[model samples]
Target: MVSLICTLQDHRDDVNWCAFSPTLLATCSADKTVRIYNTQDFSEVPYSPLSGHGYGVHCCCFSACGQYLASCSTDGSTVVWSTDTGEIEAVLEHPGRNPVRVCAFSPDSSHLVSGASDGTLGLWDFRTKTLHRTGAVNDTTMVACSFTPCGQMFVTGSTYGDLRLWDLDMNQLHAEKNTHDLGVTCCCFGPKILSGSGTVQFRLASCGQDSTLKIWTVSRSNTGSCKMQLLHTLTGQSAPVLSCAFSADGQLLVSGSVDKTVTVYDASQGTLLYTLNQHERYVTACAFSPSTPLFATGSMDKTVNIWRVEDGHSGHVETATFSCEGRKLLCHSRLLVSDWSEEDVGAWLCEEGLQALVENFKANNIDGAELISLTKETLASELNIESVGLRSKVLRKVEELKAGCVCTGVPDEYLCPITRELMKDPVIAADGYSYEREAIESWIATKNRSSPMTNLPLQTTLLTPNRTLKMAIGRWRTSQ
Candidate 1:
């Protein structure tokens, strides 16, 4: 049943954010509009459109309880709306001409953190309906910000290829890990699983331009400092990851890549479990529902795709066409939304979207260690040559072996008796038995099984299944 359910189309421009209201759904689009629609009907009733930002809308998210909606704009304005009346409850404005990239509500729904092109963090208090404080950093622009599930703290990533962890309670900075060589695009939190144990706890997953997905274990000490250690690195796709999400059970991870593929991986082993290729262009966003096996994705191909993650329950519907331009796609249960694709080339960005899909256990410093070691071993096995070096050495050895450079001094036990031809596709018998083509060849070459055997070269023939290869071999042996 891998199919996508069709919903209503309300946004005229690229829809950036979609959130579930208690009974309805709200979508924000670059058309400088936010519209609320009934979940049951795709038809649009009378809806309020908040208009103030001079530029396109970037993103929108609902508060924990879905009472308030937060929207960020390319003009660097952040607005909070009352869901009941669609009135502007709070406005967050920045002086810089930079665009607002992301805004997220804390678990308590009291504070909202926003990242913008100005390289600053805006913290707003809902009670005051005003900006609480703006925190500035020396880094490049910030792209994505996320609060831990516990809401004790938050983290932000930037185009400078760095991630900053912060503690909200103490306002003290925690450990920072810099791994990607490029900007981060998106980030998601996942659960930490104990090795070899079925039960799982909580952890964080991040994606970025590095074309990698990383998992980190979040740690907090008694001093109120947070530390995130690398857990695993998942890499296979060649393009930057744009989005990622964890399944409802927290046991599966799905990632969308600019390579135009959505890959499902074993979250624990970082194994490439499945690849679903339906989008013709980059897959911008993906989300899993509260129900197991159900998921949805948005893509640049102008579609909202919904499918079941379970092995044969694919909903049968492959893709959902939106009939509009899409950039960032997200799904909450069955609700789906998409955002505009960014055009600015050099702004601070979210964590690279690829790293959020896998677990990256190595420290930033130890990265590339495995690749270096592998290269070193490959070089060491070759003979030393002044000019041609490894290439000449490898060619010379290949020629020698091809010319039957059998070693006479070596002990028979230390040698591999199977010839190259036999080892090419060797197989063991079901009866706990093994045979080598070389041994059989030697017996046939020597005309060994009978007295009528001659040294003449045996005729080789190809026959159909009615005269199987096994029968041919039997016939040859009998002729000897």
Candidate 2:
């Protein structure tokens, strides 16, 4: 289920684009400003209403590390700002001094690309703040740009209704003509790289004035040849689709349309999931949070609406008593086994259909911590269990608990500063702190250049995997 969470009405003009970092949301508008908000409470940041652009801002995006924000404008410049302080870091003028329509940062945050009204594209080296190259298509406005997960290539959509793929060297790799009957409005590459049988594949979603959203599979074979194939054409929204984005996991797709509606789909299956009708005017922009089950949509009415996707089990009708009880026990399974009390252990055994063992567990005063450590020897000797098969079943259930439990007592140090979630793939950042690899990478790509904990400038954007911490977390999980 999806429900509206909040509506932000701070923008004074048409909202042009919306973007999200791990912990923040950014929206640009025709009022010539960019606003930043804390995702935790949906509160505006202290230095928000960023006014660097001389003309209406057209697009905005965060650097991978969440250190910087980039916004383009009709002023013919793409400005990069320090997300920490909301100060302009650099101003990159487009080659032809044309109105900049869209800007995106590469996955590694090493490059920033800005597309212009005259079809000119500027590729900038983010670290050195220099223009690395320039390329363009003829006679059409460049409106959309997105880099592939591998960072070796990117896709661009233009007013001419064409989608073109280009390598980092500014060479055109492939082009699909008439992708949208009228004009292509936006395009985004999924966050994952799928590889099998000597071919690397990517998913791309593009929406257009044709009033449809198209999913395409772009693949590169071992021989270096590339191909693009249409996978699905979504028609949930009746009016022209203006913007589209993929969830961080690439499992869901969302689009905003001129019909004053927002549509979300199961991207993998090409099935409509929900249609939202909250905006009073044309919906122009939409974005999904990289680390949470939340999405934001912006409209020409100058409002931004935040919506949340709830777990499927929520709000479902219980068909049977056993099913309701099973659902309740499943919720409890999220608690760390180490923190479970004796009663919790007893309840767990009942839920596991080992009701005969409940009294045995309670008689010996076994709790969650002890339950996780149980083995065949303990079941036979300490718990006084006689049946070998029963003991093995109990041990197997305990093992499953250790592997699946997502408990609340995770050590603070083991949580990513950006997402505030327990780190699965921990990595040490240049800030000398550990974070989930994907979280920090998303932070670096889209937020400020400072340490999330220290509020001090980060010296570099490099991150090193914390394998030791990863192993420690694994051990802790097993112990729980």
Superposed Cα deviation of residue 45, candidate 1 (Å): 5.9
Per-prediction RMSD in angstroms? Answer: 28.6, 19.0
Which TM-score value belongs to model 2?
0.66
What lDDT would candidate 1 get against the real structure?
A: 0.54
For model 2, residues 437-463, the per-residue Cα lDDT tens digits are 886676566444655555455899999
- For candidate 1, give the lDDT of residue 316: 42
Task: Rate residue 168 of model 1 by lDDT.
Answer: 58
> Whose TM-score is greatest here?
2
Q: Which stretches of candidate 2 lie over 4 Å from their true place?
A: 313-480
Give the per-residue Cα lDDT of candidate 2 at 357.
Answer: 81
